[model samples]
Structure formats: structure tokens, C-alpha cells
Target: MTRSQTTLAADAELTGVAFFTGGDVRVRFRPAPAGTGVLFVRTDLPGEPSVPATIEYALELHRRTGVRRGEAEVQLTEHVLAALAGLRIDNCRVEIDGPELPGLDGSALGFAEALRSTGVRELDAPRKTLRVHRWVRAADGDAEIVARPAEGHGPAAAGLRLEYHLDCGPERPVPPQNFRCEITPERFLEEIAPARTFITADEIPALRAAGYGERVDAADLLVFEPDGTVRGNAPRFPNEPARHKLLDMIGDLALLGCDLHAAVASRKGGHALNRDLCRTLRAAATRGDAPITEAIGVSTDPAAA
Candidate 1:
């Protein structure tokens, strides 16, 4: 089956305080033509410079994913990207009046909900897809991500599947956790999008000293205390940290600018490792070393059941 490219049918907007800057930010999602991909336009800046949300523009930020186009930069983009990618929105123009996206609820649920309300429109163009044909891996100490070809055919075998293993060490607040899921709009919204970003209680002071998350409170996100308890919130899932890891991977992998068909596993991975996997897969696909498929459409299998 062929899959057509998709974009928002109408405009959608969200507003909140940025996680890093602690300033008000408004993001507007506008529909774009097929093949346009995702572009972030700095509406607040002079001339409104735009940055393509592709691996080529990806920047290694502290504990977050970012992209830059010369002097124009957007920080903490993973949640928004994850929302768009999870919904399979192929083309969009994301206009924002701030350097960073709003950190609403520290999850992608808000963005996903807003985009869903706008509905999606299919385009005349076919969707671009990349299928992993060989093993590819990226590692940083104990943190790593690996991708390999999917087995079988049809939609179920041609979509991305992710598994995450999170272990913050025996002395850390967050305990060992695991999560696995095949990427789908429904599953993403319910199982992954609501998983909020979290931090260890001890890391707060250093983050503050580095001028980040000043306006953020425990209620705005998850902060695990040393006693292995959330400071001011409850876990949406028993293994929400692992699910959030998968959420971050979905966003970081979206930088590929195409649908991915692979079985990817991560162990204690973060933005840096996720981006590294994207870079590796992208390089392989660009070199014609990996199998490239187009418009495989949605999966029809009940593997996620």
C-alpha cells in the first residue's frame, strides 16, 4: 500500500513558559505543502529566519535536542518534534516567537492534542521512508542505541519499533525500568506522549547555576527525590521514565526527515546518543548502503496488542 504525505489541515497553537528561558513562548503550527518537511520559523526575530528540522541542522544541547540555522536557534525541540512525528505529520511550518519551545507539562501531550484538533490532510506526494538493512549502533559509556532491519512485510513490518531500558544506578532516585512499543498514533498519544520529562533531585542546583529551568517547578515536570519518589507529581505509568526515553527517541529520530522502518533498542540513552543513531542511519542511507523504501503506509499488524 502507498502512503501519502500529510500535514495539518488547519492551524494549531500553544503557549507556555520555556523550560530553559522561563519566558513566555507561543508556537503556531501551520500546514505546509508536500515535501516541505518540518521547518521552524523564528517569528520573533528580524526577517523570521527558518531552520529545517533535519539531522543536518541538529545541535547537541545539554539534556535536550536543538536545531540551528546560522544565528537562529531553537532549543528543547524534542517534545514538539515527537508530537509531530508520532502523529506522522509529514510537512509543517512551526512558527514560534521564542528561542525555545514551551515546556507545557514537560510532555508532548499538549502538542499532540492541539495538532490532533486541527486534523491532518493527506497530500498528493508519496511519503519518503528509510528502511534499515544492516545493524547500526551508537554508544556513550553505558548509554547506547542500536537499530536493525525489520522482519516480514506489510505495514506492521515497515514501521518503527522502539524498546528502552533505563537504569539510573542503584544510588539514583529513578530505579530500573523498561518499555517497548511499536510507533503508532494511538499508542504514542496514550503510552508515550504523556510521559513527562524528569530530573534527579540532586541535579537541580547545577541546572540552576547554569541558568536553566528557573521558572520550572516540581508540578510542571517530574523531579525524582533521593528516596525514589516524585517530588510533587505521580507517575503516569509505572515506568514512565522509560516511556519518556522512547518519546525523546521518536523526536530525535524525526530529524531523519523520513519515515523509519527498524527495530531500535536503547539502554540508558539520552539526546546525544539518540542524535548519534540518527546521524549514523542517515549517513548509511545517504551512501546507498541501507535499503530505502517509500510510502509503505500504516502498519496493519496487531503486534502491539
Candidate 2:
């Protein structure tokens, strides 16, 4: 069965602390017409400039994914975008009164639950879908993300699948973890949405020194100690970090502005490598090329997000 486009049935609001700024932000998700895609409206700005949630508008920042329009930018948007993609929301207006989104529980659960409560309505138009006819890979030193055509399944039968591998080194705080799964709305909520964002215990001081995560604490987010133990929180899954990485990948990939049918594999990949791949895909789509077997070069600089 062909899927129809979707949007919120009604408006919903969520307010909490912005991840980096520690400022209070209220985000309202409102229904939008078909083909609007996802848009971020800055209510705090004088004219409420809107930024399209697409690769063409994505901005490169440290440890986070964001989109900008002129002087307006939204930071730490992965969780909310993940929630929207997990719920299969095709078009909506994400209105916020701040520069960053709230870090509710450091996971996508809150956003997903709020959207579920607001309800989803199928739009009259058919959903937009993208197909990968060949392999495309982007690498940034030890980190890499690859997208390849799904084998065996017909063009209409195949759906998006994510296989993620994470390693912070055996001597590092977090242990090696890997997760592979098909990404469906139900599966995402049940398996991926609750996985919280994490940071190493050693990085806390640097982050605090840089004036970040002011409102976050050990109990509010995951903090892996040097001994591979959580500081104040417990892992929802044995390999929660890997799952969360997949969650971030899904969120970042949503910038494609349409449903995608492909098999993606990532090794120590984060926002930087993901964005690079998105840029390559957008260029390929713009050129209307099929079977783009050419390898897209990845950045060699190390990054974490």
C-alpha cells in the first residue's frame, strides 16, 4: 500500500531547558499543508524567519545538527527531528521561541509522545519517496556513513534500514556497541526513541568550561564513567549508545525532505559525516542522476556528536 503524507492533526506544545543555552524554550508543533516539509519558525525573532529542514539549509556546528536561514538558526534539533521522522510526520511547522530546542530527558521520547498525543492526520497527497540505486559513502577519518541500494526487495517493498557501529576505543569510557534494525514508526518508538544522548565523564569539565549543558546533570542525561559505568542513569538497552547513534542518524537523514528506501551503515559516524552524505545525495538528486556509483569523499577531521 502506498503511504500518504502526514502532519499533526492539532497543535501541541513542549517547554523545557535548551541543551546548550540553559534558557527556557517553548516549542509548538503545528499542522502544515502537504509539500511544506518541515520548517523551523523562530518566534523570538522580529519577523519570525522560517528555516526549511533540508540539507540545503543545514549548518555545520560542533556536536549538533542545525539549519539556518539568514541570521536565524536552530540548534540541537536532532531529537525533535528524530521524533517527527519516527512518527512518519511528513509536514509540520516547528515554532520555537529560542535558538535551541529543549533537551527533554536527553532523548526523543518526550517529543515523540507529544506528537503522538497531538495525533497524526494523513494528507491527501502521496508521500514523496527517494530510492538509492547504488552505493554512496562518505568518510571523515575513522568515521564514515554509507548508503546503498537495498537488495532483494522490490522498489516498492523496501524500506529504510540502519546498521550502526560505535567504538570509543577499548580504553575509553564507553564500550564498543553495535545495532542493526529496520526503521519503522513502531519500531523506532519501541526501540530507539528512549535511548538518551550521552557524553563521557572526562568531557564534562571541558563542556562546562565552555558554558554548555548548564541545566543538565548526571541524572538528566547519560554520563559514562571511565570504568564504563553510568554516573547517575542506567542504560535502557545493553547497547543504548549505539541505538542513540542510530537515532541521531535518522534525525539527520530526515533533512532529505522525503521518505527514503535504502540500507545505511555507519561506523563511528556523527553529525559531520551524516551531513556530508546528505549534501552528496542532494547534489545527486539535483543532477537527476541514477545509479550514482561514484564514491563521495568524506572529511578526514575527527568529530563527535
Cα RMSD (Å) per model?
Answer: 5.3, 5.1
TM-score of 2: 0.94
Model 2 Cα lDDT, one tens digit per residue, 16-113: 99889899999999999987888999999999988888877888989999999786799998899999998999899999999999998888999999
On the 0 to 100 scale, the lDDT of residue 287 in model 2 is 68
Best by lDDT: 1
User: Any idea what lDDT model 2 has?
Assistant: 0.86
Model 2 RMSD in Å is 5.1
lDDT of each: 0.88, 0.86
lDDT by residue (tens digit), candidate 1, 94-208: 9999999999998999999999999999999988787777788999887889997777777668789999999989899899999999999999999999999989899999999
Error of 2 at 35 (Å): 0.6
Error of 2 at 84 (Å): 0.4
- Give all TM-scores, in the order shown: 0.94, 0.94
Task: Give every collision pair in model 1.
Answer: 155-299
Name the regions of candidate 1 deviating beyond 4 angstroms: 291-305
